[model samples]
Target: MTVPASTAPPQDEVSPDALQAATTPQSPARRRGADTRALTQVLFGQLKELEPGTPEHSRVRAALIEANLPLVRYAAARFRSRNEPMEDVVQVGTIGLI
Candidate 1:
């Protein structure tokens, strides 16, 4: 799922083929449902150290947020009947994760 940054041509090169792919809306990858729970528990278990503000700590926090995004989306979906947009709701929920 990792797209290589180096694979992108420089801005000055502007090829039509590349532009099409770049503008296309890619479907999100399927989330790891069952494994997410165990993975989240393991990551939380490793947070025993006192350095909560460190880069490693940030990465773990980011991983936890990414791992549980589906839950946030689900929670956001409950508010779909309201006037707010789903995307905005999901975004707010995502920030709440941190």
Candidate 2:
């Protein structure tokens, strides 16, 4: 999510007045979903370029899993009333995600 310094707008070039906008704030869940989608797209693109079983491919695959962990947790929360351990639920959900 880090923007490179070279791509940053210069401080003097930014207008404070232009920064004001009337917009509804997005909920954290919505924002996170959007971010996850974008990250997954980028990572998948990278994954396609990498040869399977290479270190880079493995790293990107791991990143994809990590980035989507929130989704697994969210799904796992639905089963909370079932009396199963939360960690176990998440683990099973993660396995499905993988």
Best by TM-score: 2
C-alpha RMSD between model 1 and the true structure: 13.7
Residue-level lDDT of model 1, residues 26-76, one tens digit each, is 654433565788899888987666388998888888888888998898899
In candidate 2, what are the lDDT values of residues 14-94, reduced to their tens digit?
555555432557789898899999999999999999999999999999999999999999999999999899999999999
Model-by-model lDDT, in order? 0.84, 0.92
Q: List the residue pairs that clash in candidate 2.
A: none
Off by over 4 Å in 1: 1-31
Candidate 2 runs further than 4 Å off: 1-22
